[model samples]
Target: MPIAEVFLGAFLQVLFDRLASHELLKLAQHKGIDALLKNWEKKLTSIDQVLIDAEDRQLTGDRGVKLWLEDLRNLVYDMEDLLDELVTESAKNKSEAEPSKVPFLLPSCCFNLSSRAFMFDRKMRSKMEEMDNRLKDIITRKDIMRLTEYNGQRSAYRPQNLPFPTTHLTEELFIGRENKKMEILELLTGEEDDGTYMDIKKIPIVGMPGLGKTALAQQVFNDDRVANYFDVKAWACVSDDFDVFSITRSILETTNPQLARECKTLNSLQDELTKNLSGKKFLVVLDDLWDKNYENWIFLLKPFRSGVKGSKIIVTTRDREVASMVDAQLITLEVLTLDYCMELFAFHALGVRNFNHHPNLEVLGRKIVEKCKGLPLAVKALAGLLRTTNNPREWEDILNSKIWDIPEDRINVLPALKLSYLHLPSHLKRCFAYCAIFPKDYEIQRDELICWWIAEGLVEAKEAKNQWNAGLNYFNDLVQLILTWGSLRVITVIYL
Candidate 1:
């Protein structure tokens, strides 16, 4: 399943609670819509388990099952929009109503508002009836559709017993990143022009989550030339939270553990950092940064300013906006070519860099490699999956499996991708999850995506002057996070 369904049940439950709340229930009763809402609540609750079952089966990547699940997901979105409409209308009517006064001596203005509310209520009741009928029709298809219930335990794509190094970077196992490593090294060691005022320069290594931004940064950070060039070196994995004090404390710890243990306040930490870095060139690697606040970034860089010229900070992140905020030179990593991907896959799958010994597996192996889409992490993961299974039939089975069908827990790539998704804000998560509704490689128009986001109520209208601008901002944030392509008119949801 696309994992969006994992959240669908909870979202529906929230809506149910909102509908059943005292204020809304009283309003519904007054408008003669309570009975309809009661019916919806009952039907929705009954089918909640069905949605969960469907979600599990969808993970198997069966086309028919996926279609059915998409239908259910669309209905959920529609129901949510309808609920929002009802809440908005109710609030508007309450605001327009006259204050409680002599009931018998109500003014004509009050009568007009009452008539409008009644008409709106009737319209809403009709809409609810239509939705109820649609839900009934969808439920009746369950038996005919033969939706399979998931019974097997959740399995990830990668094997648990495999000796493949998924987390740790071994220089020998690392392939296809030599050129990128050299480029980053050159940036770190290369001198800046005298015209540039900043003493410490920053270079951001940005790419999609599984594109190996961290690994590449690790390679560069560990390079002998880099180690020899700088007087001091420190590393921090600043994932998500970019607390100024915590980061300063980490830098202090990396440079001098004793000073870090002794310093309790931010001022003391900064003083320690300054004392350690003053007049000495240093290299700092802030890996996996997600913060985009420009002020916060500048505040973090204050102590680094005391370091000597040629001091460098290499920030590895999935967001280009973070790179821009730090005024860093950007080195965006691209997906590997087929040649390098094949080489990496062979090394993991067959314990060699080439498939000469198993010529029979080459053709099938290349087909499997194509499914990886030149992502190094995915290539390594699939290779790890095939390491023990040398049979041609087993290779073919892997080649045929959909990426979504692969269990994320066992698969290094899927889990890495899931982490990126999990870190997204709730609104962005909804918007991005909805993209799963499109077919893989489907070229999405920017405007159409924004419109869908607005319709789904994923983007807050009050946050911007109009829904269009708000949607644009949401889209840009997703782009910055490397979740989607970076183009206005064209974008594609990368197959996870």
Candidate 2:
């Protein structure tokens, strides 16, 4: 029970899982309180505006914020129970009116509310009014608590679609990963279908968060020479949530965007994918995968089987269990060596490989890198913030940051991450901040995150771009802010 954020999972389930259901909507309709439900929906949306900020405030041992969060938690749970009751009651009503219509798991005899409709309505309406007042009271305390609503700048984020990854254009950007990238390239191009790849020749680049697994995968993916060996190529960002239909669609979108748009079903998408990949030496990059279900894995590969024997699928994941799912000849990535980490910091900060000239900043920079504990993302984020300045005091200040004082085990996010987060435009900040609620090393699918932002109203929709596209731009901005294969100068992993 993380009083600040863990309850968000339960809150989201109530908001999304139950509230979005047709059964609840039908119940609201029958009670003629659909308008009231919609108003509550708006209230919950308003509550979301302050939650991440409240979570941040709660970390300070702000007793007031903590109390507010506790109150909010109770309210969310009560609302969830109420919604569940409504749906259950609605289902029971349906089962009673048409006895054969009972839902599979729910027994008609299990009814909590009476078959008498007025009794149910009388009890529910009073509860709904109290919840309504509860939500409003929470909303009023929000301003007193100094919760800033994030209505982001729509104009600041204008990035278009995801940048196409290119290895040749970005190969020189890597630091110590050249060897690993070369080794993987050797496997991908070579017929090393040894025990490592098992039967499918899938290479799993397994590592903990921020080790540059995705960056390494990108290097291998964008390698100029890789294009020559594979006849068909596709890259899919398969984060923790495994939706085979979406993944199949993502692969198709890479191979044939027009055809992908035409596809509506898994069967159709896979058929198109199989036809396009048949007899080809394909290279499929499934980046950041977390799912370990064997049946889903097999089902996902139904189209890939059409590709030739030399076909390759590069899977990057944090879970070794995921590697086991693929019977991976695992290429587990470790943190960069301290020297490499320092060099990475220097390269990003001073635009030099080492602190040969600026000896004044070298000591502080090394100390800062040491604090980062060889996490490339941490080092790069800190270094990138200092890219334009060679000031020693600034370096010292960064080295002495309280973020570094947050013991490594206790802090889920890197201190440098907070520094980097501070530099982000307001628009990207809200979306990126929401990500903090996820546990460390949580694998987030790109679109899934974008959709969450849209659903949560974190994305500001303008007439020019709908919420989804606005979210995409927010996502892209945050992606580039952290790591982009094409542009990030220091070292190349965003979510590392």
Candidate 3:
């Protein structure tokens, strides 16, 4: 037998031996419950302070902390066992004396002692839980707080909520995408229905930066068909680190707010998710998935598969590879067409009224919109940045500046985009990073050298604009390559 098992068995044997002897009850009766409890409380306080001091000593490894914690736990267990024995003895004595009703000797008691032990155990357990929670909070804060740098400005110091663009304001705001919406609908409905099991289709929406992939998914998420179809809906922003527990907690909070307190373990989380979703359809949207590992995807999806059928997993990412890796039936989102793009820009900038009637400003507005290309993200970003500005000169300057031409190393947004780029394996890296040179949203023919990439020797083919098959392969391959690489940008997708 394992040493741990042997030791545990021995510990229990010794415990039972002492309990049968009623040693705990005798000690409490001899020493007085109040005095004994006062001593135990002192010991507990001392142990807690010692643990805190040891933590401050900056122990090299967790071994010391683990050992100390284990000792404390063992102490608690022993105390609980002793209390149980005392309670049993007290009950036995009371039963034995019950027949002598005329004497009814005062059942003078270890009741206070037993109560104190129970209270002590409760406090100890609470403290342990609080300590564990504090440690997790520290780790999470370390990870998240690194995202922003303190600039010593009051404006920066202000605690601001996510003020990024929303789906409502964007033109592509579920603008006119029916086919993709239907695909999502089919996954949630259709003949694939299992009586209880939900076939989790992790559909990854992959596209380049500024593509309205997230916007499209968000639209579908809020669609009346989707809302009506899934009985339970939970949305979580799974940024880079992808803490399973945190995400689970967020979903639990969203799906059934009261159960958040009950979710303490992964198993509990799974149980809660299953219990809430059983016999009821559900939709879970994991936005901004950055992790590429199948394990990461599987770990989260495993529980959902057991959910009621027609339950769906929709993930939006810039990396098509992530989509493919997760077996997401790829919904490739392309940049808006010229007409759609112009319409979106006019809607945002001119606010539904036609600005084209104004000769001079119309020309200037068109120039500004053209500079943003057909990319809704960039247009929306520029629009929000310029929303308060009515200055014609500022608009012209923004239009004239080569913001798109900003060097890869200099732009904050470029580096954020590059984070996903840098994480790709070498072969994939060479294929993807090569596409960085293409003008934003430039629709080079699929076979057209993937033009920039071919010249860069990232791919083997030369430009063949007329060969549809070759173009398709090249386009699909490049699309696959980029989507696989993933997007690092943090901007929430919003349609204007």
Candidate 4:
């Protein structure tokens, strides 16, 4: 999701509240632009109805929707500034004069003035109408855009390929998880209790997105112990919309590129793959499997069945269903503890496992890791963001920033993380977005958070008596959905 999209829904909620306020509308009427304000409110409501859909499609890399969102964003910002100016002017007028029952939002001195001021009013109306026209254009183009996600965009921004999917090891680059690596090694190298084996077994490493499922797989796969155990090993990234032929070709390319090149169809590729793995103890790591189509999964397994008994395939995925569909014993990767995450953070950010000498940053660094909620990809990306800057305040700024507010190019772990956010109910999106205003280290009380949610209009107050309980229920739903790494690390995050 675009950073600007983060606040759109919530900001619109507040904007509507202000626009409907009698005092603000009186000011607009005083300026003789009340109709323009009303029109804008209506048009923005229309856009808000489809804002979630537009954001969903924007992730699909739709050029028109992207442009439309950019236009909406710029227009929203300008409109907000204009509203702020009006409010400030109205406040000044109120403070200068006595409060009367007249209900005038701004005094006559603001609008009832000389010809030069009347000319200024006319120009302001023209500008307001022009902005409304732009909003109208956005609506027109939105209809044309049919803003929705495409099939391919599921994997468009996801990191699917292994950095070094070969015999060469990147274990040093992977921090911590030695115990996990050992457990997987035992599974990979150990035999059945009956001292027998099937043709091959699937070792599914399942976890939520941004948890470093691939990195863990890489750590285990590239270990010297496993490298010396299997006769054949290949790593293929099977992201969304997994195609049998494409995956087969990728698997074969690591084994025999020339023969893989010769294969042009699913049949040819699988047959070649079968030959490549036949009668051999093979280890194939299918990294980032997103497809849950059991038929396709079973079909893709045809060649693997030809491998020698005790051969194994390690599968890394964010979905448990995909892991279950593989009919394998799955290993759930737990969230790294704060200690492990700090080390991982420092490693990626400073190319070492500890902060050692950066005393000014060590505390901020831990808070940054806590804000990351111990998700490795987010931790690494955010740490990488600080790798170039030593300023402690810069670290603080990033910590203080909302997940979406950070520039995409600087650190982008949110694409995968946003999937969890998208699954949220419409009301919860605003609830979650508004929570970004809280300080990262603030220890929140349930009652306080509930009050804020109700005040922000993110959730219906229902009857005032039940509003607190309603907010409490919504907060609980968020807790169940949130990626909480440690029991004590409870915090509302835009990163999901």
Candidate 5:
């Protein structure tokens, strides 16, 4: 859809809200809709005449303003009975939620004034902004823009980006758990009907940190049924700060890269998104959520009310409380089973099936995998290291090491992975450590982080083809070493 379509959609919504508030039932019986329609027609005709004159003189100075007026007029004319029905339903719910006073209606006079001001070509952007401000003021007076209360209890964003499906036992690594995955899918995507609001399914996948929540989510995302079921699919990585703009951009980029490019702010991005998702069956996956506060989630999800029935919002989080707050049908993920664990282990270790050839290596490999204790990160990291070396001595040495013999905490691959970290240039080391400040799964901005690294004397500006190129290469090298992760653990510059 075009930008003109969005503006029109918003206008129709405003009109519908106004109509519903005016008590259409009473209007049809008393004032009569024919009279009301006539009134609207007369006002609209006058507005259209003014817009037509503005278009003729657009070459003088009003090109942008005239274009905006035309778009707004087109939007009003685009309103249909379908939109009126939705607004009526929403108004009924609103009235039930708060019944103490007479409902306030949207003012078309305000809209028309705004549209006319937008037609003034003398100060294009300023005039348009002024019109928007006026419109917001009217909406606020009507109590539609009231700020709701929110809680701020979480101290930090504990992001969990699991590298595997599960880690209960060896079987978990080898045999894929399609059945369990589906059970989780059913729980997360079940439909529920309540009389007041139209029924919609809400599924949430929750689990402990590093317990394969994200991996399981990936499986659901790629499932054939899910792909065909949802009309609109979007993925938002809600790491740490929960920057609305970045998440919205990620959603748009999932299916509409062009729209993502056109968005620069959260409001604009959301406006574009709401229009794209309206009346469509949408499946939105919000991954790595740490903010458990209900109010935050509600505000973010408000626009989703426009989505079609059966649309589901899948949230992957470590906090059960977050799942509850979002009113989601919960799928609590647990550790992988023994067999499944082994399968995942084998995937990382041999990189292929039929790994029974080397008797000695197979025995040692099983022992090594058992030591990993179903943690996919440990298995994958070890497998990646082992794949490069052909020496049996190296494998045996790894099996016999104190690092491998220590408790799980001491056996953390961070220390072994530190070998890769240690090899980095001094400047790159500082750059890598800078990543610690970010929450897990936080997408780091390329230019900004690089600039900080340069400012901190971590990267010499004179070392490369150009400062920008040097910064990019240094960032890329660190990413390749797994010192950071994103988009399948390959570093892509992200802002937020």
Candidate 6:
């Protein structure tokens, strides 16, 4: 029972409650429907506290409580379905009876219609009573469980007195990226390959979000060997939106600031790029690319072909598909090792490479570092959170807390990770959110997951020959986006 499930239950309750107030429902109120509606509303009104408490308990790994919460969630879903069915039936009846404009003009037919309405009312009343009994039973079980609301005070993980810095770290502060730096440098400065038609060689640095891809690129970009090898250099942050002209303009400005100030048209921009890069070995770094359109990549790289044979373009992206589309030699980044992770975490948290001054906190710090799973960004983020705190209890609390449970606005690292989730389309969002039901590090079967998505009505109903194919396409899109990692042959896995 994730917090997401609780929020979803609350949302469904609100929707069904609104549906309970329709005109047809009002017309049937006197047939014992009004009392059932009142009882349902009364039971649902106080569920917010119950959901919050369940969420808190789930976060703390209260298995027994989560089982109970799951039961409540299923009941809520059943109630929502029943309410929706009632509304649909009521609408259908209203629509089907609309042609009879003058009931008094046909007395015998009116009497027959009244009799049918009475029968319909009796059936609905019986259904309502059955639903009411089911709800009452659930309520009694809830009371016996004594699931109380969360009464503990909430506090920010980061210290209130010390404001966290929002800027990127200097090279001196970056740790455990030396091997990656050397590899990228070798690729950038290596000898040009022979018999290649493309003048500009492309090298892509690919990894998950916040794995320090940009930092590694920046280190290589500013290195003396790289700077000396290329005559011209430019860097651009090509985030989700990949506008060709904007990127071209940015390249021009970085290469020659004076030319960019005067160039106004695409033709002029291309001319300037040619003039500056022609016959010169150059390096261009494109950071955070999300676009995978091969045509767009070709268009963006068109002007760079005029540069010398050794000229190279370095791309940093989370999506392997983007890397593939760019047709670059790939330099994939892996997570840091435990030792390096600890070094990085300690540097930021206690201003040292080791916890020598605070040896007593070392054990707690190690536990927190384990939670980071060797991801540099996670390590850095947790370090930032603990920088202002000297309490062992605070560190322990973070060690035990689930990352998703943390408030997004407070944790800088989470928003970076969440951006990938937020950018997904509505259909993909539902599919991805549904994965929260699985435990961490669980190997998810692609076919089983798709089946579940279809069953949940998350997949859109189209006139496709196979609906599972549509669901598979949705899963592939998520994989292409690097939100989940696996292969078609094996299994799909989500880190969170």
Per-residue lDDT of 251 in model 5: 79
Q: Each model's C-alpha lDDT? A: 0.67, 0.70, 0.51, 0.67, 0.52, 0.65
Q: 2 or 4, which is superior by TM-score? A: 2
lDDT by residue for model 5 (144-190), tens: 31212213211111112334322111222323456758886675456
TM-scores for every predicted model = 0.53, 0.58, 0.48, 0.52, 0.52, 0.52
Checking candidate 6 for backbone clashes, the offending pairs are none
lDDT of 4 by residue, 1-496 (tens): 2345544654566567667777778777665567778888987777877766676555555567777888887887777666766667567566443333331323445544455444544555566667778888988887787644222111111111223223223535666577778889999998532322445788999998677777788787778888888888888766665767877998899889999999878899988888888777878888778888898888888888777766888998889998899887889987878988998888866777898878788999998788776787667656655665677766765565333444466433463255435434456656767666665434478788888888755565557768777787777756543422111122333433
* Steric collisions counted per model: 4, 3, 12, 0, 23, 0
Which of the predicted structures, 1 or 2, would earn the higher TM-score when compared with the native?
2
List model 1 lDDT by residue over 1-496, tens digit each. 3544434543454456566667777666655567667887877665654554554455555566577666666776677678778878878866575433322223445434477765665576667767778888767776566644433212222213323222213335667788878888888888743332355788899887667787787678777898889888888767666778877988898789999999999999999998888777889988778898888888888899877778889898888888888786789999888998888889978989999999999999898777667777667656755676677876764565434455646343343243334334455656766777675345578899998777655665544458788788777666544412111111132333
Global fold similarity of model 5 (TM-score): 0.52
Better of 2 and 5 by lDDT: 2
**Per-residue accuracy of model 2 over 1-496 as CA lDDT, tens digit each:** 2223423522443354466667677666655577777888787777776665565565445678878888888888798788878777777667554333222223336334355854665677678879989989988888788886645321122333546544323423478788888889988888732222224588999988778887798788878788988777888877777889988998998789999999999899999998988767789989888898999999999888877777899999989999988986899898899999988888878889989999998889888998887778777777777776777766765675444554566655556765465444445655665676565446579888887877665566634358777777676666665453222221111223
User: In angstroms, what RMSD does candidate 2 have relative to the true structure?
Assistant: 13.0
* CA RMSD per model (angstroms): 14.2, 13.0, 25.2, 18.6, 28.7, 13.0
At residue 122, give the lDDT of candidate 4: 56
CA deviation > 4 Å runs, candidate 2: 1-172, 192-199, 423-479, 482-496
lDDT of 5 at 392: 65
Q: What is the lDDT of residue 115 in candidate 5?
A: 38
lDDT per residue as tens, model 6, 459-492: 6654444668889877776554331211111112
Compute the lDDT of residue 220 as modeled in candidate 4.
79
Give the runs in model 6 whose Cα sits over 4 Å from its true position: 1-170, 192-198, 258-265, 402-496
Model 5 per-residue lDDT at 81: 40
